[model samples]
Target: MHGPGSSGWLLVTLCAATGAYCLLRMRSSVEEQRRAAAGEALMGFGMAAMAVPTAVFTPPAWAWPLWAAVFGAAGVHGLWAARASARHLHHVVGAGAMVYMAVVMAAGPRAAHHSTTAGIPALTAALLLYFTAYVLVTGARLVPVPAVAGGPGSTGPRTGPGAGWGDRPELARACRLSMGIAMVAMLLTM
Candidate 1:
């Protein structure tokens, strides 16, 4: 999974781009959106860094523990935030997955290479299932719903200009869907 190759680079690019978009989302006027985007930005960048090809640049011994520590803190923060909004629960899961991966990587080169034997199979399977379900559900939610003409809930094409890019809900959902897919890919490679 960490081999130096085009696929690895593609994963890096995808994650970094997602992180950048999440950073943009942090500019939203909504306080909740800002907080959520901040957490997502952290996840995206963290994933990008962790996805770096091992053959090209294996991290120093200390880096793995640091990665685990950072994501562990993020997970704790997610748990706290989840009290206010259920959506933050997903962040907690993502953070926990990152910590798990980091710990596995820290085990040693042999452990990293033999991922099947290194980590607990059941835990990995559970994480994979969670991410897979998340991807499917988010993808389904992305489907556009047709508006009925003159319906009670119809606002008639949203007066004035549309929302700014950072405030657009559809794009946010797409961003999340992309991350979920990326997480699945990462876990499968593990």
Candidate 2:
């Protein structure tokens, strides 16, 4: 087991890793809603891990430009989905949080690694805390997915619980649960 010296950091890593596993499981599920939820959770994990290294440790000057481009791409792409997922509170909030994280990290992400500077570390700490809360709260929301009831004649998906594998509602719930646990763990660490 990884030592406990950096429990906080370890939790952060664990959440990210577990989130990834859940995503993979989601994909393999015999359900479509599960697939979509897995996919969305993967995106959430990506956003959370984007600037983690920068948040936890200082990097060489060369790292800035590289990270800048990476975070910039993530922010821009997340914005692209921002409009469509606007109706989705989880998506909206999560995407917005990612943008905010990108901005904070880009502003000067290596302070904690360098000379004493409370501002950067303070900001990082605050951002981590906020996002952690966001992940926990948002993950609780229930998204509806359609499920196919009966037989092939009624192959279409229907709402409500008991939706079988490959159904929309089933997929939706799985996505939420998976994302929720991952985010909650992440937030707790922060």
Candidate 3:
């Protein structure tokens, strides 16, 4: 935790803004869409909580352990949910990272210890690398790549309730990008 002018405050602001957006999107979505976007909403809230400025609100003694348990269970469920598609794998990884971070916060000697080998904390370094690659890969996939002409391909861009901006897929991508940026900012702060 730090003052309003500090990096911690900046992180808190960014994460809160993103989380609010996600919640807004969820509220605006229909039942089916809501079901599909549940994971994204969770991600948004999770990131916001993780980035919260400590000075503004100190978590209860049980908070970190509880969060670890919740996210760890979510991660395991995500693995089972990902059996049919690789898409949900990211959720598993993100949830796992959250669990790891919560566990570290709950038990590690953060204030008195520094990394013996590298200046960066081992967990932070690993998470930074993972999220960096994830963001790059996801962004690349989102780029508009032209498909083969008339080769079992349909007409142009989709247009409907679940199409274009504000759709579940788009919102999920936005959430992912925001979380990746937040993770980078957190690592830098550490």
Please report the candidate that would top TM-score against the real structure. 1
Clashes of each: 0, 9, 0
Model 3 global lDDT (CA atoms, 0 to 1): 0.69
Candidate 3 positional error at 167, Å: 1.8
> Which has the higher lDDT value, candidate number 1 or candidate number 2?
1
lDDT of 3 by residue, 22-130 (tens): 6666654465445435665676677678777776677777988998988888888788878867777878888887786777667744741456487776877787788
Best by lDDT: 1
> Which regions of candidate 3 fall more than 4 Å away from where they truly are?
1-5, 24-36, 108-116, 142-157, 161-165
RMSD of each: 2.6, 8.2, 3.7
lDDT of each: 0.85, 0.48, 0.69
TM-score of 2: 0.43
Q: Which ten residues in a row have the lowest lDDT in candidate 2?
A: 111-120
Give the per-residue lDDT of model 1 (tens digit) for 1-190.
Answer: 4745777888888889999999999988778889889988899998899888877888998998999999999999999988888888999999999998899889975664563554546677899999999999999998977778787646743333435778788888998998898898888776
Superposition error at 1 for model 3 (Å): 8.4
Error of 3 at 74 (Å): 1.4
Model 1 TM-score, all chains together: 0.90
